[model samples]
Target: MTLKSVIFDVDGTLADTEKEGHLWAFNRAFQLWNLPFRWGVPLYRELLNISGGKERLAYYLAQHPEYHPLSNDEIREIYRLKTNLFMERVRAGVVALRPGVRSLIGQCYQEGIPVGIATTTNYDNVETLLLRHFGVQWKHMFPVVVAGDEVPIKKPDPAVYVRCLEQLGVSASEAIAVEDSAVGLKAATGARISTIVTMNTWTYHHTFLGALAILTSLGTTQTPAYGTGPDGWGRYRVTVDQLRAWLV
Candidate 1:
């Protein structure tokens, strides 16, 4: 099947948004709220298993009922605050696109292959990052962006990826999803789309059972990716040509 589109996951897959972005924002929110809880790296890593930020917070709270009880509304407010903080950090240039990301996306655009984002991250956060990096017209660059709140269920469920494919008017077989974690891999594969796993500091340990390629990054020629498969491709510095070859 020919590759018609490339769907990317925002948080980790696009940039190291988890560690340098969201986690810090969440901690900052907690501090601002005087919540007495800080999501240290280890705890946050484990919490990442839970898809969305609000859901992660709720899950953590459920695990520790001894902490101050916050209603659903309160959780939403905290999350809103966290999202604001995240956007502020993004605008301040705290986050950066992963290696080869801009090159690959540009290549796809140049080739008329649509690029979409299927992420459990909030829509606004995605926009913030895109606008910060790709400028005000980022929406024109990424025509299809299906975010966390847009779907009833998040990753590991496939609803978001399915929605993204639908919006792009592309079939699962015609698109490739680039994901960072196991849940994301599950979501894309569950939708029957081929996926590429780009491991980051937080997601390096997650299983990527069905991914077409699992790499350290989307890698440039200067910093080539080191991974398990992509059989015929050099497996170093995944380029647009390599992706086209893989789709065959």
Candidate 2:
């Protein structure tokens, strides 16, 4: 079936903002709270495989309770602090939207295809990205946004997807989702939406067994092969033909 709407995940999928984006922000929060832990990119990747920033914080604490233990209130407070730091980094122009992001969204807009975001990030981050990438009024461009905390649950739960479908007024089959991780793939799959995966920093090695297609970027080549990595899945180039081949 032809796609009626397009849904996207914000972080690794839309932008390569994780370098100093997530890890450093978490560190900033950690320092402010005097929490004796510093998260690395590898650990951050594993954490992202779960869902929701708050959940990730909790999960990390649970896994390594000996390192630092923070109650739910404390976790929320620090994460809020982290969120602020992250937004500050993003606002300072430290991160950039991945390749083809602008063109793909433009294509969607020009073709009258509704674009929506189903992300685990807070609405503020989403809005910041919208303003930074599209324009200050970018939030007005899309009709639907489903954030992590907005719904009763997070990714892999399907609640957010269902909510997004409801807000967009589209059937699951009529919408397509773009994801960057296996957890995201599972979430969209659980929601019964066809998904296109774009491998990112830490997600480059995971299996995308059920994605309609997997690629490096939305604007590259229609059929991207294993480029220069040992895994043969590290690089890809997606094209309109490839996108149309799947979306159509």
lDDT of 2: 0.79
- Per-residue accuracy of model 2 over 12-108 as CA lDDT, tens digit each: 8888767778778888888888888888877887787778788888888889868857789998898899888888888888888877777777777
> Global lDDT for candidate 1?
0.90
lDDT (0 to 1) per candidate: 0.90, 0.79
Which ten contiguous residues of candidate 2 have the minimum total lDDT? 223-232
Identify the runs in model 2 with alpha carbons over 4 angstroms from their true place: 221-242
RMSD in Å for all candidates = 1.2, 3.6
TM-score of 1: 0.97
13-49, model 1: which lDDT tens digit per residue?
9987877789999999999999978988999989999
